[model samples]
Target chain A: MKSTYLALILVLASAPLWARTTPEELAEHPRWKALLHINQGTTWRYQGRSYIDDPDFFLHESGATDARAELEASIEQLRSSESEARCDFPARYRFLSQQLDWPDDGALSHCSEYQEWRGAMPEERVALIFPASYLNSPSSMFGHTLLRIDHGEDEDGVWLSRAINFGATVQGQENSILYVYRGLFGGYPGYFSNVPYMNKIRDYAHLENRDMWEYQLNLDEQEREWLLAHLWELEDIEFDYLFLDENCSFRLLELINLARPESGLMNDFRLAEVPANTVSSLDRAGFIESVDYRPSKANELDALVKQLDATEQDLALALAADHAVTEREAFRELEPRRQNLVARTAYAHLRLQNREGERSQAAAERGMALLRTINGTPTVSGIEPERPVSPEKGHGTKMLAAGGGMLGDRGFGELQARFSYHDWLDNPDGYLNGAAIEAFNARIRRTEGDDLTLEQLDVVNIKSLAPRNSFRKPVSWFVNGGLDRRFIGEKRHLTRHIQGGPGLAWELGPVMPYAYAMARAENNSAHEVLVSTAAGARAGVLWYADGFQLGLEAEGLYYHNDDRRYRPSATLNVPLGRNHALRARIERDGGPDRAETEFHLSWRYYFD
Target chain B: MRKTLLAAALVATSFGAQASAPGGSGCGWGNMLFEGNDGMPMHVLATLVNGTSGNRTFGITSGTNGCDTSGALSYHGENMLAQAGVMEEVAQDMAVGDGEALTALSVSMGIPAEERDHFKKTMHENFSTIFPSEDVTAEEVMANIQKVMNQDKQLASLS
Candidate 1:
């Protein structure tokens, strides 16, 4: 299962088909598809509204989801309608006055005619409720099972999810909802006790994407980069997103590229105290603020809750006095509210009392504040925006150079050996560019047994636009493959093959859909043939906007391999440099064996 | 809208049967489990039907139908007792015109006094409350139940 999943990841990752078939598959996943298709042929902007329809709550914070504002207006309408309801619906209104409680069980199975399409959806249709549910069923946390529905018959349907997870990105997909948050993978779990029914619900979601990669999120600095590269290598497989459950917060920050973007790193410690700053011991003050929040004894909410609790108690007593109730009777009515106030006071008091005592609260709070100082904030001191805290002082590579290989073009073989080095730019946007080859090399094992030896530097190009703010610059890509027929001993029998191509690259957003198209040539030394062409294309979106790149290419070959059985095939028609891209690839020759199905995965690097 | 109305009609026609609930003190497993007038009993599978689109969908409604203790449930006399309890509750709650009580008694399955209460509560809450009736005699309730279940086709206008 694991291997099959790995193979699937490699295959699906490489296929550039973000735009493909639907209509039929639409029936199966109507909700999510509906959200996408709703504003088709529309750009990122429609009128003044954003064209990006990720029904998640991000837009809700801005109060943008209510396009018509009917709900907003309903609140005002309620006041005036009360008079008419009292006059004409005395009895009808009475039922609603206390909110008639029906048998919860009876209602679950039987929805009234009043419910519309998004009715008691559990039975109507299976809804893919996102971030609302992580792993366990709501029964554990909430008493009953919660199934999200946008519309329903008797119940207020039209809501998105029935069951939800905490702090999840519950997007309202047209056909189904999906969570895109950090620590959510695995699959939705049903309630612990609901057994058979809950089990059935789990079975319905069908989360058997056997190829998902699992890793602990709490890795140290070196291991963090180490794992990210591994994640990048296995990018060929399809997955919703990576969930850095344990250390996602910091792990994600470390992956940021400050150089290409901002082109500098904040003095992680006190800038003045930096080892190189020996001047005044890098003013610890400069960094102390980064890890600390300006703390005050009394917070705004703490003061407010205290005052409100007292005020409410007094009001309750006054109300009782006005009605002439027993002191004890009135106190009961006012008690819970007062208790609620007390709870708030206790919470705030603890926050203030727990300041900087023996516990590390003071230190942790200071640390958090310090992070905010340097996070996304421009400099407060005289530091240049592009200045690095340590600069490239400790950053240099000892390249493991590779000896040149021979490439036989048509009739003759050519050999060339060269040296090249790549640097690790802390910008995530450059994760796919040809600049960060150094970082890539540190992660995966492209070569077996021994540490990978970098041979001749055939090509490297890494460009940056706003690297931080603006994501418009197009980074070019280049690839070179060469064959070593001799001297390599064990690899002697294999003909040397080398090919290089360079093209433009662009990322739609940070860790988002990325693309690069380049033209290049390939040659085999032992076979004595050089095939060249500009008709190759590779493209696919990175999953969850992560650094994983997926692409597919169909190229017309310059020279075909003569393995008698395994014919290396590429797809294209225009003999060589047609304006058309590397078209739909076809496996024309399945080697000497008439028919075969196969997929390939290659590790990559970017040197900026 | 159409689905909701259709679903409502099915609810109306099913003629829910409820049994009176026996008293509450340290009730045994069966008593505590079956006390649910609103939800499914622990062992008793509740077949909830939510028919929208007016499609009267009949999902496998497997249970001790008729409460006859046959099929896989034949071993337990609970079904038979439950059925009789239901009939007794109806007869007791809706005692009819003078001589009618005797006739109902003849047809009654003879449930115990204790079990009768369970039927009454079940009937009241398991949704027998849908067709509201005030001061309905014993024979009338029995007759109505029979007619709904297709055992008796006769209908008597209130006098």
Candidate 2:
């Protein structure tokens, strides 16, 4: 009996050698295509091999290219030996087995460290956190996205949970200009990092004063486990960061696609992935369960200030000021609740003031003393503002405008469009109010003589109109550049123009008034001088109501070569619906000739 | 005149005891050197970082940057970060007597929701002692809180 059993074991062991697979046969399998696709492997015909985008994600020698060959080799290796640290084998193994109808042998095994990490990872829930657009920083203008892995109880544990952040690990110090250049042109290598959610909250909510929105993913336990495992597989993997395409938003979408391949989150986002666009895509995939908002310090203070009476607000300011004896005395004379209100308001006011370097050290100390004086006072002023609409709720970022009107004595047909982003009067419901950012805005005109001309091409235009308040004195600003059609006497000529300036803006009831001292430089194509620099002043007032917005501006410019001009403009924006608007603009230019007037009426549509 | 004499005697004896004791010191220069008394250096460092970290008191109030009560517990057991942060919020919402600052303070102190009203009342009544002047430190604020707690049986029991 022993001799017979030995003979049978030898025969069984030799059976797998009889039908070994060729590389060609392995490559033909559908399972191989799926596996290679998930690894982000592409055939480099010139190099005559395949390579994976993330080198660290796969362990097999041919894992980067020739997915079938790698799979067949890995399966053979796994069957032969144990304890190999093929970190990504388990998922591939399971996928191949189920797709190819292979036997359920426990051949694929994880290393001890990988197993330990898997056990330690959260299995219940996942959340996508987006810190909204921070216009102050060039990098975060499109906003940023990260994933939070919930390990404990739902609500409260979110604060202490771990997060996965993918960012470009800049090698050394770079100034803001260099940083932007490097970021846009793939000058930095991006890497994924794991950090606690508290760190992000610190950076966004308090330090940056940007609100955060958390969208809990509707992934089940199995999906969450798969995502967690894949995240671990991607640990320390490096990818060249391209600001436009392979950016934070794009990479996160790719990661999601790995876990839920059927959703194909990365399918339509091959070219560019705006943060809000990616968020909308996730919603479309039916992955988002619910959303939670965490207000920034600025938002909280704004809400709190709205609730305070004028006298209480004054007392609050006085308490924050170092030398306001009269206000302090008046504050003390108030009732207990009022006193607490004044103190709380003062404390909040000082905190915001300190951000702009407006508060002195002594005044700050007094602010703390005022708080301690009213400690435990039961003033229930938890005035959280109603949450803003989600970015997905806003109209699509791209805009198309079409209409026609007259330019001086000529009748013309006009078409204008912008590739991205919001404008101040474009139904500021789901966007940052009073903020406008436009990229690649172009306008083309057709004259009555059937001549098509490019009127303007704006490379970038960003305007931030932050209104001043009692607590914050922010300097609003504008920056714009590109080719513009300026009327030189009677004919229109395209000029290369770059202009920006710092300005002050104040909100008075429904009208916001602003003034700016601008330095403008332009190179007119049909001018005697190649470049002309001008020092100009512009003042404008914007009156806005429910669905109506009207703006009026007057500007006077003095060029370096004793050329002087004055331009006055007015724009009226009326909302047609949620995603459409009608606008009428009129401008008068006074130069060597009499003032020339250009009027236009256009209809604008915002997409989804 | 009699009271002044007693105060002088008390000061003299206290100074003599501090001078002769082994490793005993005042809070000033000694605290900076070896932290022999008051741990004033650590408190000062905490205060300076808290004020200069570009977050201001709002960072602490919002529980960002680890600016919570657990961190920077001064020698007198006062959470300086919390004290500075809560003051701002308390001053903002004083009329209602309830705000994020007070809520955070209560949560950190393990005060039950039912006892918050009493806690607020005690602090409001003892405000004069807690903040006797505009230059009061977090330690003085905490010490005054303890004194207030001792005088109120409900607060003392809760603490």
Candidate 3:
């Protein structure tokens, strides 16, 4: 048998890598990247060495009245689920056979027979043999280190696989001819990606997988859109994924961002549209509870007026009086999802105004969010509320209950704020640039200094921040004035006006040292309409300095107006001290033109 | 019998012509070192003709100039000469080498490793960088290690 294999190897080794696909490559075929890793489970880690092996900790965490009962129940459920799910490998090897090959001690002989039977066919002279050790859930890591390779080779050339990333060298027995199946990348069902970056590949897969037909099922695009109508339903419903189990917590978030790649439109009604529709339909069908999120504007207005009367002038400030602008910016970026927290507080007051015994309405539209009242107090969770996860009720908290993410929120925000910066080293024409309005923000707070400041766990005075922002520019160079409704925690409020306008976007070029053009015609008095066109391209080696961002956007925007409006903006984001960002830009905003001649220099703390 | 031998020789000669084509012999073969570690017997895998030596027969654990890449030889017998002592034992019984060159070769040639982390930390990144053929990898060109293990001490296992 060994000699037969050796003879076969010699013939295969001598086989000139056929121009056509080889047997091994064809074995992997279109779905070669989909070998499941039958290991990497949480239970394996929980048993000992990696984490808490203490029985006390396990008992405390499980929260089950009876630990043994919980374990038995869990096992039963897993087996049931396993039975319900489709068996990945063919059925011939489902039961152990009498005699076969290496590793398998007289098991899966039928599998070998099957391989022989399949190999007998003339069209394709190959069979994908399933080693017996892998027959039981080949998706897990312990099941098998399986792979398919391109077996084409001339004595001169050989073909290899590029899917697997090995943790360490193989034991010389099996070649590193494959990529491992750690988990899903993007939203691809039962598949992994070979993309270079771990997260980047996951993100790309996420964005592309959103539109898969598997996600649609019998529902048309309109039904999907209908389900997305409610904010909660839109955010909560995941059609394509029959199982909510994503690659990992970190990967899930990265995939979410990937799915929502175009960050400029975060609250994009696209996904929300269908998810909301489903929630409404499901609620009507009595599957999920019909949440009450709608609250009256009158209730909010009344509460504001009463707070104004009740508070002494100094008593009302956004958070504590000791907090600085930097602190507020810190809070805004740190707790962006605090929008729900504030909404919950507002609903508390709205609930009081409701008629006796009548249910109060919900104010926020995101149906995916849940609101719970604790001793007449209310709060909200962004993705999933961290209430006691009632398995019987079929609910749980978010994977990222604590998004203690963002290495440097403040720094990241600042770097992001310089959003629309271009270095004219490359393209000189059609280019679009603008800082996302996530930069426009406020930190709301309330004060109770003279009162018995929470005597329990509460301190004499405390501060908390909540983020608020919204603004988009269309065909620029127009004055846009708006108002800021600031809040000091649960009480004091303030509103202010904002005014600014004028914006332009041009298409950059394929022409080397390209000269791009831009045209403007908004004759509104609130805005200025001056045809300003300037294109001078300089050649500088464009490359990224630190991290993955390419520092290659440089060009002089020379407006032909009386004063040459040169917005020569170039900012280099130097991740200096722990995301302690240092940015510098040089722009001749008004050089021999009537455009505003001001060198804009602004610096602020990023994440607190 | 003479005609059959001639026909076979003619067919083999035609292989040379085909080898010269794109994705042919020139792109095959990644750099392989005579790994001397633990109980591993140093065996020559292939002889690279960097300089001419008239193809004189050489024994295992023996080489005049083929081991030295800088030397000008016509044939490298049974192994791609490598800078010695490059492969090192990291910890207890654990060996690690800058096998990127081998890795790129393996990946490009479709020779997956039996032990994933065994010969990792590849230095040769681009499979196409060293060789012209897109079809070759270190796995295919690598001499069967078992053959190397079982061969006569005098004769190299592969070349």
Q: Output the number of the TM-score-best candidate.
A: 2
- The list of candidate 1 runs beyond 4 A from truth reads A1-506, A511-517, A530-535, A543-608, B1-159
Candidate 3 stretches greater than 4 Å from native: A1-86, A89-534, A538-563, A567-576, A584-588, A591-608, B1-155
Can you give the TM-score per candidate against the true fold?
A: 0.18, 0.75, 0.24
What tens digits encode model 2's per-residue C-alpha lDDT throughout A1-608? 53344345335323554235455654544334334444232111213233236654445665666565666665665443352534445555544444444555554443555555555455567888888866443335567788887754334435445567666654323454565576667666665655435546645665467788899988877666556655554554566666666677766776676566556454342445678887888999898999998888778777777777887776667666753543456765878776666666666666555432222446545555655654645455456866988777777788999988887788899999999888777777667766788889999999898779998899998887778878778778888899987666766678899998988898876788989888889999656888889899889988877788888999888888776678899999998877899999999876765567889999999874
Residue-level lDDT tens digits of model 3 in A37-104 = 11113222122121212232121334123333322332233233233211212221121010111133
TM-score of chain B of each: 0.22, 0.47, 0.19
lDDT of 1: 0.23
- Highest lDDT, which number? 2
State residue A362's C-alpha deviation in candidate 2, in Å.
Answer: 5.0
Candidate closer to the true structure by DockQ (higher is better), 1 or 2: 2
Clashes of each: 114, 26, 136
Sorting all predicted structures by lDDT, with the top scorer first, yields 2, 1, 3
Candidate 3 Cα deviation (angstroms), residue A2: 54
Residue A17: error of model 1 in Å?
A: 77
For residue B41, what is the lDDT in candidate 1? 23
Taking all chains together, the TM-score of candidate 1 against the true structure is 0.18
